[model samples]
Target: MPRTPRTFTVSDSIVVAASPEAVYGQVSRPALTGRWSPENLGATVHGTGGADRETYVGMVFDGHNKRGPARWSTRCTVTAADAGERFAFRVHAIGLRTPRLRGPIA
Candidate 1:
């Protein structure tokens, strides 16, 4: 007998019964994502708009992530932070211990 290769496509979704503010409160803070994510272990906000204050457009955050047994961090800058509307960031650098390199990450 011969073995057959396997291919799988996985997709998942969920419907949260919450208001926009509630959703935004959870999503805007990078430090809180670790509570729900598997690969992401959360982040540490740098200045001004730290996790304690409101999110802003120029806030910098160090994102910590892990996969299987490997761990790494990424230097990210918040590009958009519209309360209860939109939130986004850009990965500027990456490294194992610290993000020594700098630039727009692919």
Candidate 2:
């Protein structure tokens, strides 16, 4: 039998009782995400001279993630970084040895 491709989507949101700038300060800092997210262990900024606190378009970084005993890294590049409004990065998992986990047994 031929295998069908699988797709999954995950979404999450939280309400913070603070100014947008304050919230952005916390969320945009990749170093702090590990404390809140169970899957994201942390990230390391790539290249030289660019401070980890400074994020701009085209900036590159590596994200470390864990799912139970499985661990992997993903390369990310900043696509948008608007203070107090929006910050986004694109993740690439190419050339990674990611494990394929089977669904729960019936």
Question: For this target, which candidate reaches the highest TM-score against the unseen true structure?
Answer: 1
- In angstroms, give how far residue 36 of model 1 lies from its true place: 1.4
What would the per-residue lDDT of candidate 2 be over residues 30-100, giving only the tens digit for each residue?
76678778898777777775445577888876677788997776767788889999888766543233323
Name the runs in model 2 displaced over 4 angstroms.
1-11, 94-106
For candidate 2, the per-residue lDDT at 47 reads: 77
Note the residue pairs that clash in candidate 1. none
Candidate 1 lDDT tens digits, 9-67: 44565688998789889889899879988988999999865678788888888999999
Query: What TM-score should be assigned to candidate 1?
Result: 0.79
Candidate 2: Cα lDDT at 58: 88
Local accuracy by lDDT, each model: 0.84, 0.69
RMSD of 2: 6.3
Model 2, total clashes:
0
Q: What is the TM-score of each candidate against the true structure?
A: 0.79, 0.72
Q: Deviation in angstroms for 93 in model 2?
A: 2.5
Each prediction's RMSD over C-alphas, in Å, is 7.9, 6.3
